[model samples]
Target: MIKHSIRVTPNRKGIWFIVNRGRIWLSAKRELPQGTYNELILSAEPEQFCLIGQLGDQDAYLLVNHDHIANEDEWVTPRELLTVSEETFQLAARAVQVALFLQTHRFCGQCGSAMSLVSWELAALCNKCGHRCYPRIAPCVLVGIVKDNQILLARSNRHRAGFFSILAGFVESGETLEQAAVREVKEEVGIDIANLRYVGSQPWPFPHSLMTGFIADYVAGDIVCQPHEIEEAYWFSFDQLPETPLEQTLSGQIIAQLKQISGNKKAT
Candidate 1:
């Protein structure tokens, strides 16, 4: 007698991030569409795509949808995903950045030849010129200055009254994250800081930025807001603070840490 047996496997779902003209598609429930084409909410097939990462044992793909104005309400910017869980926010960050990279690096800068995606890595290569390009990430620093139980905050010229955050600036060509933090604080508020402590880092996808946070001790100098940059600067007591970034952001995290260290109530 002969016996045969068949084994069956469950089909896991993949998270699809459909992007059109920089905006990502969300389900009516306002969530990333999961599964393959069967679960994809959009109708257009992608002309470009990238496997970003895995989420919950399922793969996550970045699909570049065609440029159109259909279902406008379903397409939301990455900023809208800030309230989502950290995992979702992270995938969305990579999706948008990768999409931007694919869109911008379609041609070789050296030979003006068409670029194609590399099979083994997240990069675009030009066969003619042998040139390759990868996603760009700008490094930025967020410095939360502390004096006694007070924290130094500033409102940039671009910010409205009331909303303020820790001092932030981009890392220059030859500058380190620590150097950038100190220089940003000094340039924006005309102050000196000592005893800098590394706090944490966050992926800020406002056009691709990695924010490295630091807690610095206020050493000297008065608040002299830089023109054309800082609208105002002040040191506020931990208990009484103005509007600030959300708790999901690095700035907010550092602020919460500082308040906890001071044994003060959490900021609203």
Candidate 2:
């Protein structure tokens, strides 16, 4: 089973954190310092503070601001936290998402009134309009297209040179996850796919995205790369695949699964 170090809970305070823009303040040991939530809340004001969750035995609090804290020993981005540990990355991602949500939804959209935090849950309530706003999670699809021992991979213009991975795209409104996968493959590489089996999902919080994974069979059409999105497209043999993303991502997970299946067939 997967282990999570941080647990979601109602507002309480034991450990203090300050977030400026997207960077988080960390101590010399690359850890969030401990401080009283009550004191921090009083000084920082309730609007600037958010109760993220419980980290082990302490309650984790986040202070969101546009200005940096001079008292902080070090400042690091969420990507930097990934280098420390998976648990740290998870916590940092969650914190950043919550912080961004709070920052963006400071006022009610329906009514021009300041919103208030709804205790016992992760949401904001507008006293005037009674409108509740929750954190946003954009759903996306990542697919690995396999044909015999070859898997279809594409290099996107956004990715670094010498890196390629599975086809992916954001799910449009009123579209099913399966439909999104099929559409993404068709649009990016100009091919049809079948047997789109669901593999797994991963929370990719570059800006709060939940990526669902799939493995599909190549159906028809030659690879005609999408003009702006795909830089190159190719079907790679299992033994001659290009450098891809790490296993921590859904695309990597899909590729790893295909490699294992290909290896098993070769062995048998």
lDDT of each: 0.81, 0.79
Candidate 2 ranges with C-alpha deviation above 4 Å: 1-17, 32-47, 69-74
* Candidate 1 per-residue lDDT over residues 115-212, each given as its tens digit: 98777677789999899997799999999999978999999988899999999999999998888888988899999998889998878777788989
Worst 10 residues of 2 by lDDT: 1-10
Q: Compute each candidate's TM-score over C-alphas.
A: 0.89, 0.83
- Relative to the true structure, candidate 1 reaches a TM of 0.89
Q: lDDT (0-100) at residue 168 of candidate 2?
A: 92
> In candidate 2, residue 146 scores what lDDT?
90
Q: What is the per-residue lDDT of model 2 for residues 85-121, given as tens digits with 9 covering 90 to 100?
A: 6666666777777878888888999988998777667
Best by lDDT: 1
Q: Count of backbone clashes for each model?
A: 0, 0
